[model samples]
Target: MSQVVFELQGKADAIKTESTLSAFIKNYPVLNGYTKRDFNLAPYWKIPTRKKEKISFETINITDSLKNGASFDDVLTSLEKGINRPFKNRKEHVAFCLITKGEKSYLAMTFDHLVFDARNAETFLDIFQEDFKGKKYDGSLNLKEPAHLSMWMEKFKAGQRVNRAFLKMADKIPPRVLPLSSGRKGFKFKILTFSKKESEAIAENAFSQAGYLMLMPYALSASVSAMHEIFAGRGDSGNYVIPVSIDTRKKEEVRRQFFFSNTSFFIFKVEAGLAARFPELLNSVKEQMYSQVKADLPGDICRASLLMRIAPPSILGSLLKIYLKGQIASFSFSYVGETAYESPYFMDNKIINMFHMPRVPVPPGIGIFFQKSKENLNVILSHLDGMLTDEESKKILSLLKSRLGVE
Candidate 1:
């Protein structure tokens, strides 16, 4: 019942530019949605005991001797290095890394999946920046001990609808081994930009025919179908499993008076017969998206029954650890909404980029496409080691554009 939780804290040394910092904070979702009790999913709901450690400035030992730049690669490397250390303090927190790398002049916070949704991650950054400047965060957020898994287990055993759905789904899913390698396996994340003009054109085309705005899920599914045709030689017609997260926080809130999130898998079938017509592919995706948005897990127990077979935290941790070093489910895709709650300000810096991770290492591949503007779209692709080549990806991208008649 304990959710997996990871905590790493550190501060970047660059003098705080309130403008730059504020812009970054605004890029995340939690600030608007968060309340005093809106803890990061992991910190609040994880099933394990919590842990904490305090390290002084000198202990972090980060130096600018090597090189410095705002390159995303460098930032990612630094964050990864800090998170490699095991958590020593297990009491008050069964997790790890409290004040992970404090006084380093940069703060890095990483959360385990059991908690911390897209919104929570953003809120944590907002709190971290405010705390760094010695400003009071009126939100009243705090480091909380993990919730008792036993309580969840009790409810789960009692046949709560969600738990029953999970149990049923777990029973039908055969053991699945993903083709995509975990992020820790040295998978580099690449940022692909789509202009607002281009996305609008695509969405317009889809809506003209389908009568609905094109969503990330639809774009993502189209991208996957195209990739499969290019790389796998297009003869395969079977269904490819794509995991989409359903924010079950509403259900959890009813029971515990707080938000609890659950992820469920959806099957996206490929029809090789329509290989020439990519628009139809996107149309198929829209249909699925429309149905999935309202499809309640509890009501459709048969489909739910099939998905639950994938191990929950306790089992996934063990099986995924060997092939992957850290974090399982690295390569998966979803579309979380993007919009600023209020105007963002930092030390005269404007926020230009917004990035969120896709479920890492979900067999075939994982791609997360997000709406960056009314028309612009941003997609982050995480592929398994040497699976989908650059040429392959490009072909898929072209298919999406040409088929959709996007600019």
Candidate 2:
């Protein structure tokens, strides 16, 4: 995961301030148990039981260069470049870069997804904020155990049932061919945002008409419309199948253990006919989503993680790769709603804005992430490199903007 956090400061604060951010970074729990790689045991692979010996942390300061009035984009771009470069070693899984220009500063953090998911990442931020405020760190919570083989097999059997149900549903409605971009290679990402007023308006409109408070209906509908427009000339009108990610932190067992990587995917299908109108399409999507949630599809998937303990990594990895390449055309994740960090200031530096973008893997080609901080809504577009030409990417962005009523 990657994030861009802006620090608002004044000239006096900038001149006098020594970073309070470092303390939070240094004091964070090692969480070494979560960093272990899969171990080979002949025909099967097992998750390591032992925690890593050490955790390395580094912070780079670019305040001198940014003093010339660099834009946030410039700082973000630089930080991204640094993140893309190879790390010195395995222990270097987390790092921070600080950029400052007079009173304003930007802090970027890049973390390996193996150690953090979107929800847990927010939890880490809360911990950091508390530490910055001189609050005591809580160490009583225990880390969740990784799913074992028995747990996975049970869930796998349940997931099989869910898949069977999904297959039956697909037969009733002809599956839509998602107009996915072909011949994509590396990954690429883009970010778009809506102001507090605009985000509120969009949420209000969606809720009033569709009885849905989330902006996903609007976002998904817009994406479907845009893809349909892009592929209409090609006669590719098929049903859309989107695998939406569900955060499992709300689960009693998961929450109790402080599970850091608790997430599951549920397939959301919408007929091509309903894709034209926002409200109807939103309702259709919402119904399917709610049905799966009620059925505990995400929980089943979470339990299925036990497969890691029973299956050989090579075979399991290949199967998953094939599924990602052929089954789904797009993915969506939302981190909208309330956040724990309420204050705009962290230590002496004011926070200008903060947003996170999950890394997108290939085969699906495109990922859309939505995060709401206070009233501001941020949209992150991550896709495989070469998935869409420059013009195609921009056109899709324009379509989403229009759909969301964002200028």
Residues 1-407, model 2: lDDT tens digits: 54445445643232222345444444444433233344442121222445433333334444546356555556556655644555455544555555655466655566666556665666666556677677765556664453354444577787686556455445333344434555333445666768878888778766776565555656666666766565554566456667676553442333344324556677777676776777788778778778877987777666654555445546644554344434444344444344434567655666666676555654465667776666677777766556566676677777877876665
Candidate no. 1 TM-score: 0.56
Taking all chains together, each candidate's TM-score versus the true structure is 0.56, 0.77
Q: Tell me the RMSD of model 2 versus the true structure.
A: 5.1
Which candidate gets the maximum lDDT versus the true structure? Answer: 2
lDDT of 1 by residue, 77-187 (tens): 444443333333321111211121222233333344433554444444445445545664554333344333334443443335434433333312232223443445434
> What's the lDDT for residue 47 in model 2?
28
The lDDT values for all models are 0.41, 0.57
